[model samples]
Target: MTDEHDWAPDACTLPTAERPLRLAEFDRLFRDAVRDTDRPSPRRLRLRLDDAAEPVVRDLIARESACCSFFTFDLIRPEGDALTLDIRVPPAQVDVLDALARRAAPAPRP
Candidate 1:
């Protein structure tokens, strides 16, 4: 992730000391479970995750929602061994979403 506070918006209720821990949690999910990412709109982001990650995904999103009410997370389990997570933010928080998308992106191959 860029920085602990980079993607966090002013509306977030998470305490300063805990921001890095939360960011690390998100980074871990993106690195280990995220299979794909898509941007259907400026204010929305979609992540395809391994089906086995459902429990962790659920727990993470629930905690995230508690702290960041501006984020609207929708978890969908379609057929097959995959789960889709759609994240939406209001217009004012699009920048935060953008930062999250960047963080979720796969690292370049050397």
Candidate 2:
């Protein structure tokens, strides 16, 4: 996987030092939590996850918030066994989120 922080602007919102590690963590959390995902708009992606995945998802988002201030995360739980993570970024930074989403994709069966 590419080091996302490398291509992100110099003024990136996330702390630089631990970006690689954080990205790895994100991949793991997403692999475990993601049930469905789609781009809801040009600048936003909605990730639906199993309700039981909430704790890990919440923790990951909380840690991500500390370094990436530009991300807008909304956790939505409806009357079901699923939760939604609405992630938004600046229009120009949509690609950044795309890269993350790609990383979150589950490995294909061999």
Model 2 gets an lDDT of: 0.75
Best candidate (score: TM-score) = 1
Q: What local lDDT score does residue 100 receive in model 2, on the 0 to 100 scale?
A: 72
Candidate 2: lDDT of 93?
74
lDDT of 2 by residue, 20-65 (tens): 6776777777778787788868788888887888888888889777
lDDT of 1 by residue, 1-110 (tens): 24535568778899978988998999999998888999999999999997888999999999999999989999998776369999999999988988999889977769
Candidate 2's C-alpha runs over 4 A off are 1-9, 13-15, 107-110
Question: Model 2: how far is 26 from its true place, Å?
Answer: 0.7
TM-scores vs. true structure, each candidate: 0.91, 0.79
User: How does each model score on lDDT?
Assistant: 0.89, 0.75
Candidate 1 global CA lDDT score:
0.89
